[model samples]
Target: MATPLTAPTTDPGCRVLGLRERKKQRTRDALVDAAHRLFLTQGYGRTTVDEIAASVDVSQRTFFRYFANKEEVALAVMSDAEDYFIDCLRRRPADENPLQAMRAAITEAWLELGQDDQSGPAGVTAALELFELLETTPTLLAAHLRRTTEQEGVVAGVLAEREGLDAAVDLRPRLLAAVFGAVVRLSHLSWTSDTAAHAAGPDGMIALIERHFDQLGPALAGSWR
Candidate 1:
């Protein structure tokens, strides 16, 4: 997963930060990196804020300064990816339908994420390991589901905007978003269980996601004989 903290600046107007801000950024990044390593090695349930902070040689209070709690820091990587995915969806061409926009957006998002893994702080291997941990960890999985439900509303609003439809009155956007979210959840579950997919990493997961999306129409409309 691309550590959004360390992602290269793409904005032409990006300003050079002062020393204090740069130092803070470094601290936050260190905390996130330490948290991920501890979570993966010792298990999220067993890892605590103190241990993460200690690993980064910072006070526990400093960890709380950047993240609300262990869960927040633990899921920061996934949150960054989600934010990027939404941004990509918003940038999709207006002519494409909601489903097409979503499909293209996710593909684009994953491709960029994969590229970042090769050169970024946490590679795809760490990402896949973290993903498996998230799926198996009950508390994290529940929190993830709750976050996904909320994110669906945001996605639906984006879809509604693209179509010039009021999401409050029009059910299509919300309904489609729900279905898309479900498909993604199912794909995650499938990928987590498939040993071969684990070996294939991001590319394999992307293929599985595409396959799930392709099956959506047939799975919904066709009779199982």
Candidate 2:
């Protein structure tokens, strides 16, 4: 779900439309911005595709050209962050253990996202806003859960590939991935609590993750306070 904003075309013919491509990129950005604002105001279910397009002064056809549906647009920014996390996971040091790799990769991904790039501060704020929306919206929450489950399988496959094991045959990779996913879910749940002091930004989320991860060993050991 790479946005045209940062995606470079490798096709030779695409080189000819360098200026044209820039214009299209601007359109894509405008549509995404409009969609986010509309969704925030009208709610996800109430926001129609036509209205979103109308907000950007584009036709529904143009919106369809950039995004297949409202869901795609709603999740597009978060999707980019997810993609970066996966890529970071893949590039982690092979010698590291699974948990260590996961932590390091995620930390790097968060750090990278905090930079002055496309999805920097503004995008982080937008993502957090959408996350809060998803939490309260049943439809979007279900979709988010489904994506989380699917991502666990994808990550398990990546782990299996790294460990030189058949993902279908080796249960260890899948088991570890599931456990890791649960940890992430729990961390998010704790961090999202109304009384939680975390900033709701990249740094705050990272701190919550690290804190929860640090507790995994003690929890497994069944140590009482």
Candidate 3:
């Protein structure tokens, strides 16, 4: 079980994993909140994990238990969207074309139909700040790449089922799934990086994805060998 962020210390043989999990979560949350504040006030390169721990009143060792280091904290926080995407991908239809199923699922999961059309207002600004931070940090960039790899595997597994492919289909769907998922991700990146003109807000994400499917449709269809 994952450790909770709030645990001061745990017995080597403690029985309640749930409490420990919650404690670890609390500690991780504290560290992230501290680090985020420090990042904005002092800048990303200027911040340190020790300083984040100090600000949160946790020992640096406790901080390490939740995240290997400061970069990992940013990685963990920035990964929430990808994590959500994985869950939605799993819930998509087993029979529908993988890309088409993705269209409805992604829109319903992340885009609110009314209002600002971004994420919820309560969390929008924080998410945007995190997006901006990822733009410049190489460590976070690498972590994001690894996150994308995991998402690609998810897409491939769903595609295999949707296409009713057997073991003989080997490498085909894997590449297509990765390509499609990457384009979908890039569409959101464009939206996040430049939102000033997004009158449709995040709806631009789905529209951009549709354009990819349209442009690539002939290519995708022809390759179903």
Candidate 4:
């Protein structure tokens, strides 16, 4: 069964951030919004840093202060989502196994994002478009894959901490992390290739991931005959 979406709590620190920090955050958000809009409307490759900066009415130097390059801004939303999933994983119940924790964390994170009013309907639509954009664009796809690889270690470390294992010495955490990541990547590939799945959007991708995770045990341990 799917987990029900719950309201996200506001961080008290957000309220206490000084005026300068708040202003910086607003500028950063504006830049991200502008970048996504440009990336979706114009092809990611065609969108320039100057154009993104211009859209936010910020100078190119100010844009560089927030993001290193166009690719960084292009991926900023996804990076935030990944961070949220890590946060969710950290909060998962200790009784759950690593794979179960990972699966639940991702589902919880996506559901929360889907229900967020700040994200809105237009934001959801943009996310769907961005998924397609990432899959089709070679440069972005390569960068995305590289980022995914880098994140596996972080996930493994989290799992290790949960299980009280040494991630560097004990390979189980890393193994589980690799398997989980592979399952997610496979689901994404399948989603992108199938027209029907692609049409179903983020929900379809999540369902597909759940189905693939369900098959892991059977595929690894059960006989084909």
What is candidate 3's lDDT per residue for 180-220, written digit by digit as tens?
Answer: 76676566567675555244544555576666667677765
Candidate 4: tens digits of C-alpha lDDT, residues 44-154: 888899999998788999999999999988877777777778889999999998888999998887777666524421354356567678888998889988888888899
What lDDT tens digits, residue by residue, belong to model 2 across residues 43-143?
89899999989987899999999998888888776766666677778888899887888888777876766553344212565566677788888877887
**Using Cα atoms with residue i matched to residue i, what is each candidate's TM-score against the true structure?**
0.90, 0.82, 0.69, 0.86
TM-score of 3: 0.69
RMSD of each: 2.7, 4.2, 7.0, 4.5
After superposition, which runs of candidate 1 have C-alpha atoms over 4 Å from their true positions? 1-6, 10-22, 118-121
| C-alpha lDDT values of all predictions | 0.81, 0.73, 0.61, 0.77
Candidate numbers, best lDDT first, in rank order: 1, 4, 2, 3
The Cα error of candidate 1 at residue 213, in Å, is 0.7
Worst 10 residues of 4 by lDDT: 1-10
Tell me which of candidates 1 and 2 scores higher on lDDT: 1
Q: What is the number of residue pairs that collide in model 2?
A: 0
| lDDT by residue for model 1 (41-122), tens | 7889888899999988899998999999899887777776777788889999999999999999988888877876753335
Compare the candidates by lDDT and give the number of the best one: 1
